[model samples]
Target: MHGQPPNILFILIDDLGAVDLASFGSTFYATPNLDRLAERGLVFTDAYASCPVCSPTRGSLLTGRYPARIGLTDWIDFGGRIQPARGKLVDVPYIRELPRTEVTSASLLRGRGYSTWHVGKWHLGFEETYPEQHGFNVNIGGGYLGAPGPGGYFSPFDIPNLPPGSPGQYLPEVLTDEAINLIRNRGDNPFFLNMCFYLVHTPIEAPADRVAKWEARVRELGLDRRTALVEGEFFPMEHKRHLRVTRRILQSDPVYAAMVESMDENVGRLLDTLEEEGIADDTLVVFTSDNGGLSTSESSPTCNNPYAEGKGWMYEGGTRVPMIAAWPGRIPAGSRTAEPVCSIDLFPTWLAQAGIPVPDRLLIDGEDLSPVLFEGAALERDALFWHYPHYGNQGGTPGSSIRSGDWKLIEFYEDHRLELYNLAEDIGEVHNLAEEEPEHTRALHQRLKEWRGSVAARIPTPNPNWQE
Candidate 1:
């Protein structure tokens, strides 16, 4: 632990909920392997993703900068404009690729002589800007697409970076097998492997047996569509076009449950591989999600109950994600913390762990959590902020927010309305306290404004063609 740099095994899951795993209070989704992972690592109870979407949060993790600062504010859609039928404003143009100029954690680690590898989803950019351009020595499965191919999660994937497997082979299993091969083949140099899984995302497909198992479990629990239905409002983003965003109140989708199970099983496979290679004690492992569960669009698979909303809103469920870190003899076993941390913190934390000094020139928004990980110390930061200026497919409008202590404030750009909630008292964000708590709301709003100005954040502009 002192002389040699520890090998890093980072597992990032796409569209996973804060409560999707049994370790995170999910009674329905069976995830024993991830639960075992929690038992051996440090669980950050209030961990949050930078943005409640895919590309922005992923950018935050790799760059240690806020999405606004990096100019990757929205999910990459290959230059598509969101022209709602009767919208008041148009979305600000965002960068479609992770800039090659910005130095990444992979590059930093690779510069130090570590072997860096990336496997699975690389939705950050087009094919030319894949992980290999960012610092990975080996790249697999990462391509221009954010999700599985048109053929779905099974074999014969249409993705270019990944080769076809047998007829019914699963994507997560294939990715894990590649990771295991890397772990076993590495000679003596320490490695940094980013294993991002495409499970639990849209076009949810699973093995027939796994789907049947969950279907039977749902029937056994007497859960039906009526009992699972949860209401969600698509706030007025335009005049008349309102997309229905209904979420299953419980984690009851047989297909989604099967996907979760598959991810868990493959996680077990990677852990088993580490133990088999006799490097389990010397490796640092991380498990987290790119965003919250997809409970707003496409099938509305799993719900993030008690947190409010999911995937594309500025609620606890959408932004809050599950994070666990394990390094034998470094992070205490069965450790847990309630301090709020976000995805931007990982780069600095990992660099600190490897004894590398963060370069002074970079504008890193994240703080090192090494103290909290090793000594359970409280973070000394004052607040965290988020700015999403585009109408999301999952019912969220253009807005900016700030979370300070127990109070959170959101300022809607469409009408300049403010909503305040005391998260400690109301985690679901049911009661708006903006009117009752004027001074507190004003303070948070001012800070959000200041942050936006500091980052030179892009703002949506009013459309002249609106008839309203």
Candidate 2:
């Protein structure tokens, strides 16, 4: 075994909801690989992505800073400015890429002689801000495009940094091959492999055989039920641009189920590789997602119900995600914790695990969870914050939120309105106690505001062009 400095394999899934896998409580989608990993690791029931979307949370995972503090508050749509038709406000300007100056965890680890590599979705920034520029010695399929590019989960992905694969090759499967190759060639250097799978994201396409299996399973289980119409905000897409209401509440889509299962298989493959290499105990494998499920638009693939709303909304369904950390003898096997943790914490935690010093010049918003993972200790902090000043494609409005203990408060910038909920009692976030508990609301709001001031969090201003 590799003694104290274990190799790090961070597997980040895009748009995989907290409840997407069997380990997380979803019956429709089967994720045996992830479930096995959970059984051998510390499962976090209250892990969160720094943001509800992809790019920002990805940045947080890398830099250990909140997206708001880093100025990459929204998903980087380098294509152009996304102006919502008939919307009340225009999205505020945001940093289009991960700044070069920021010291990412990969960079820090690489400095300590960890051979760093990144595969799959990079979405953090454009050409100059890619994984290689930051720290990764090898970058495969990491690019600006969020989803698997044009070919959509198949060959001819046209993804930058990736060589062309055989026709009809599955994206996730191919990415896993790349990761396996890296592991096989890693030699004696302790490595850090960030396997960012572009699975269960967009295009909602999967191998025909896998789809057929899920389709049969769905029918056998009598899972095909009428879709429910959840009460959510109504917005405009201008003609056929967007759906007025979010509908797909049931996770019965055969295509999405297939994608999830395929991703799971690759996860299992990677683990099998580790075991074959006799490095399973010497490797610290962490698995989680950048954000919650995508239930609102773009095929309305999966649902994150019981927590209210899905990807893009400030609700738990949007930010809450599955997190598992395993290091054979270090992290307790089959252990579970309810201590709240977020994407940012991985930065400091990984550094702490590698015995690397946190850069004194860099400001970090995330705390190390090594104590929790290794010793079952609790973090002293009471609250976590989120600031997203831009509208989400999934119909979430611009807002900022603070979850303090059991009570959570969300302040909408459009009308300066506040909504509060006791998450312990109302995990669905259905009942608002803003008026019922004025003092609690005020204190949470004050904290949220103070956090914004401290991080220089950006807030969207009134749009003069909108009509009431």
Candidate 3:
């Protein structure tokens, strides 16, 4: 087994923002476990999900390629084609599954002799389209990432006929238990267990006991438990009655808070399981989220702002997320790296750490980040790129962008508009420097143009019924 590669415990959360963590100056909550993870490994302040939403972000993370390269630009609609809202985007339905032929981290790691396993949200798809086809032994919960995890959260068995024992198991708990079991029964060779979670996302439900605890907290604060995801401001989609039912859950609803706290508690369980198995020192654990928080849907009407809109936006509030990597005796404890990194980097980085060479023929868009994590090396790429042409429910502008050094350029598609922000000076992207610095804007633009041309992204087809 090529001298024992360090086991990887990749815990990817769903839509937890970077600013939400204490290490990133989040005053609202204290994530001691996340903070501790950052202390043990490298915490990249500039890390981002490739896309601002789930499916696309995950696609890039797995393939190390731009989402456009593979016809997966929008979230795949679980049910069918989106009928479209008049005057909006073409009524293109989401792709229910990731296309075949895409290479993944599992395929790469499995080749290197690491026992690979995936437990948790398999939003990518099911059966042939699931994690197994991509190269990992699978134990998928909330099998389809299309729905907000488990309708009520406590124990959601969305799958029509999921066995008896499954109904009583919460998705997060199910995943955590499976991961712990894997660690307990590890073979001599190091493993790579991708523990992707469907946490704190939606279907905001929790165990009755935990919810009761949350209810008591709300009562102490003199608030009602019928307004889930409502802290202040408004619920734009609460007009729908079915959604209104789920909305009754309080922002202070002990249930929702307990759901989040329970995810954390399970994280603690997985950590303890690692130490208990006597492999804690050699394991490389990463804690991160797929994208920014979700805003609203059939089951939820929440938004992660103060920074901006929730997910599906081309802004910092949507793209920025917490990224903590921990490896004992290798990575520094209580350390943080400000260099920007993306989930796609996992493919190449894991390959490098395992002493496996990434194939030059792979057309990989991400660079190996092991050097930076273990040796405090600078970000390998001169820039990172993002392209999302479709409009999502969230009030976000569709755009494409490139980040080279401190120069960042974002081009909006609605009105052929462009906005440039020197992230070094303004991380929130408030000022429009495109008019002021045409030279910098143009340079980034040309680079993007050339990149798009190379990727050969799908161009809009001629409308057969065009009146013009």
Local accuracy of candidate 3 as per-residue lDDT tens digits, 236-281: 1212212222221223435546666776778878888888888888
Stretch of 10 with least lDDT, candidate 1: 78-87
Better of 2 and 3 by TM-score: 2
Best by lDDT: 2
* Candidate 2 lDDT over residue span 273-374, tens digit each: 999999999999999999989988776788887778789888899899999999898899999999999999999988988888897898998999978898
List per-candidate RMSD values in Å: 1.8, 1.8, 4.6
Which model, 1 or 3, shows the larger lDDT? 1
Task: Tell me the TM-score of model 3.
Answer: 0.86
Sorted by lDDT (best first), the order is 2, 1, 3
User: What are the lDDT figures for the candidates, one per model?
Assistant: 0.87, 0.88, 0.69
Query: Which of 2 and 3 is ahead in lDDT?
Result: 2
| Residue-by-residue lDDT tens digits, candidate 1, 1-468 | 277889999999999999998888888999999899899989988899999889999989998999999999888876354433125777787888899988899999999989999999989888668999999999999987878978789898887688888888888889999888998998888999999998878898999998999899898988754477656665445632455667767778999999999999999999999999999998999999988887766778998988888888888888899899998888999999988899999999879767788999998999999888889998899899998888877777788889999889998888899999999899999999999999999889989999999999988888787655
Model 1 pairs in collision: none
In candidate 2, where is summed lDDT lowest over 10 consecutive residues? Answer: 233-242
lDDT of 3 at 143: 59
